[model samples]
Target: MSNVTTKKEVNVFIDYLARCEGETALRLNVDADGEVRHYEVKLFEPPRFFEGFLVGRKWYDAYEVCSRICGICSVPHVISGVEATEKAFDIKPGKQTVMLRKLANLSELNMNCIVRIYILGGPDFLGVNSVMDIAANPATLDVVKMALKLKRLGNDLTDFCTGRETHPVGIDVGRMLKLPDKHKIEPLLERLKEAKEDAWKVAEFVASLKVPAYKRRVPLLAIHREDGYALNYGKIKSTSGFEVTPYKHDEYISHKHVKQSNALFYSIGEGQSFMVGPIARVVLSFDQLSPDAQKMARKYWGGPEWFHENMPFSVYAAHAVEYMHTTDEMISILEKLKAGMDESEIMKEKAIPQKGQGFICTEAPRGLLYYTFKFDENGDVQFADIVTPTAHHVHNLEQDLKHLGPSLVGMSEKDATMQVELVARCYDLCCSCSVHCVTIKK
Candidate 1:
C-alpha cells in the first residue's frame, strides 16, 4: 500500500484486480471534496466470442465450447448449456444423471467460493495488497491452509464425477457418458463427510473478519427451487418479489452493451440494476439454507437486514455460509448415491437431438448463469446466447463504487484508491469470464 502525499485528486487504474481472475481495469477518479467525480468500469479484455463460435455447431458442441468460457464457471456453463440443449430436444435425464450433475455443481461452488472469500478477499480485509503479503502472518496463514484442504476436496469431488476438474469431459446432453458407481462414490463421500469439522472452522474464521459496511439496497436475484435452496434448477426470483421461469428470462430480462463498452448488462426495467450470487442467494433464500449453514449465519449477522447491497464485504460471509451449505448437501447427495436410492440414468441409451429452442439457468459459483440455444433439424446450433452472472453485475458493481465515493474522497490518493479497490474486490469480479471485445474505449 502506498502513502498519500499532497495530491487532492488521484486516478486508480488496476490492470486486472490482483487475486481476481482475468485482466480488466477498475478506474476511478476522486476530487478533493470527498466526492467521486468520475467512475468508470470498462471490461476491455479481448473477447473470445463464445456465442458466435458456437453457432453452426451441434447442440453437444455448444456445451463443449461454452465450457471453455471460464475455468471457475465451467461446471455451471457446461451443465446449463446441456440442460438447455436437452430441453430444446425435449430429452429428460434420469435420477442418476441429475444427482451426479448436482454433485459436480456443489463441488465447484465450494471450491470457487473458497478462492473468492479466502484467497482474493482475504488480503483486502487484512489491509494487504495480496495474499502473499500475509502468507507469513501467523494469524492469517492458518486460514490459507484450511482453504487448501477444502479446495482439494472440491476439485477431487468434481474430478471423480466429471473425469477432470476444469472443463469436465463426462457430462453431456441428456446424461454423462459414464457414471461413477458406489465403489467410486463411497470414498469421496467419506472425504466430504470428514471435512465437516473443517468447514465449521473456516466458517467461523470468515465470520470473524470485520467487513466494511454500507447501506445501499439493490435487489438480489437468484434461482428459487421448490425442493431446496436452488442451485441447478429453479425459477429465477428477485428480492423485489418477482419470479419467472428460465425460458421467460428473455421476456422479463433485457440487456444491452453500455455506451462505448462491450460488456452487456441485464436489467428488469429502466435505470434498474440487480445483484446475484451468494449474497443474493442468502438474501433471497436464507430460510432454504441447510440447517448447518443457517446456524453459522446466525452466529454473526443478526438478521437478513444485516445483509445489504452496499455492504459488499458481507459477500465474504455469504460465501462462507454457502460453502457449508454445499458441503453438507454434497455429503447427503453422496449418501443417496451410495445407497442405490435411485436407478442410474446411464442405463438408458442416449437420445438424439432435434430442431427446437431451449433455455436454462443454473446457479453457478457466482450467480444464475442463463443459456439459450436454437437447434436446426439435425441438432446443429443455429443460434446461441449466454448471459453470464458477471454481465448482470458489472453495472451493479459500478453503482456501489459511485455510492461509496463520498466516504473515500477525503482520503489521500493512495489510501482512497486501495479502499476503492477493496470495494471492487467485494464483488469478486471475474473479468476474464465477463469481458467481451468492444469497438469503444474509455
Candidate 2:
C-alpha cells in the first residue's frame, strides 16, 4: 500500500474556468508521484435558494422567478415552470400557445448550443486559449463569422416570439401573453430559411475538430418524445431500458449533499451517477432528429455506436447535430403558424389553480431539467423543488475525473491540468443553476 505523502505535494487550485457560466473552481490533490489521489469540484457562488424563496410566491410568478435562475437556460426554466403550473391547475395550453412556446425554446436551444460548441468548447479542441484566439487567427476567422451569423438568427427568433431573449416575458400560466404579428412571420421564416447554409458550415467546422480520446461507460438519460425531437414535452427515458413519465421522477431520482462542494449531487437508482445533456439526447433520440441532421450524424458518428460508447467529449459533436435540427424545426413551426393565425382562439381563457402537486421534465440546452410544485387552492405555492441539468450531472463529472486522474500521473503539471479542464468543459457545467440548493450542517 502506498502511504499518503505530505512531501512534494501539488495543490492545484483552478480559480477560473474560462468558458464555464458562473463562479467555480477545481481543487486537485496530487501526490509526489503526480497521481491525483483526491479532487473537489468546488462551486464558489452563493446558493440562490430559488426553492426556498419560491415557496410562498403566487403560482403565476413561478415562470418569471425561476427564469432568473440562469440566463443561458431561462427559456427551459420558464417553460418547465409554466408547464408544471398548468398541470397542477389542470390547464391545457391552446395549439397556438404550444406552437409559440415550442418556437421560442427551439430558438433558444440553437442560440445556447452555438455558444457552447463554437465559442466556449471550440477553443479547446482547436488548441487555442479562447474564442478570441480563434477569432484573431486569420485562418480561423471565417469560422467565427459563421458562428455569429447562426447565433444571431437564433437570438432574433427567440426575442421575436418571447418578447425577450434571456428572461422571456411572453409566456404565462396557460398561454403566450404576446404573439408575433402575422405580417412579420413571413419575413422571419424567410430569414430562418436563408441561414441554413450558415448552420451547416458551423456544424461541419465542429465535426472537423478532434476531441481527446477517453471513454467511460455511464448511463445516458434524456426526455423522449416519440413524435419528434423533444424540446418541452416527453417521457424520461434512459439507455438502461427504463422509461417513466416526469411525474415519476421523485420515485427514481435522488439528491445528496456532499461536503466537498455547495452543489447538490443527483443520482438514479441505487446511487448510480448518470449523464443528461446533448450527448445523451443525440444518442437516445437519433431517429427523432430532423432528416438532414440525422443523415449528417450518420456520416460522422455511426447510428447506434454513439449510444454504445459513452464518450463525454462527444457532446461537442452532438451539439453540432442539434444546430441543424433546430433550424429546420423552427422553419416548419413558423410555416404552420403562418397558415393558421387565430387571435381569439389563442386568448380564450386561463384556468384557476387547484390544490395539488405537479411535476414536469424539459430538455434544456445542457440536459434534462425537472420541476415539481405544490400549490394551495388560492394559487399560492406551498412547496417547490427545482433541479437543473448541472446538478444532475456534476457527480458524473467528478466520477470521470476520478477515472482520468490515474492516467494523467506521468504528464506535466500544465498538461495534466489542461486535460482535467477539458473534461470539465465537456459537461458545460452551469454553476449558477447548480448552487440553487445547498445544506449547511451545524
- Report per-prediction Cα RMSD to one decimal: 2.4, 3.4
- Model 2 regions more than 4 Å off: 1-11, 32-36, 259-263, 307-310, 436-442
Per-residue lDDT of model 1, residues 1-442, tens digit only: 4334554665666666667766657777767665777776766667788777788886767888888888887999889889999889999887778888998999899898788877788777777766666667887776677778889999998988898999998898877777765677877877777778787787777777766765578888889876798896789888777898777876667778766344566777675787888888888788889998888888767645677643577788888888889999998888877777444566567669789998888888788787889999998889998777887788787787778777764466667667777777777666656743222464
State each model's CA lDDT, in order.
0.78, 0.81
Q: Using lDDT as the measure, which candidate wins? A: 2
Alpha carbon deviation, residue 92, candidate 1 (Å): 0.6
Model 1 steric clash pairs: none
Question: What's the TM-score of each model vs. the native?
Answer: 0.93, 0.93
As for candidate 2, its clashing pairs are none
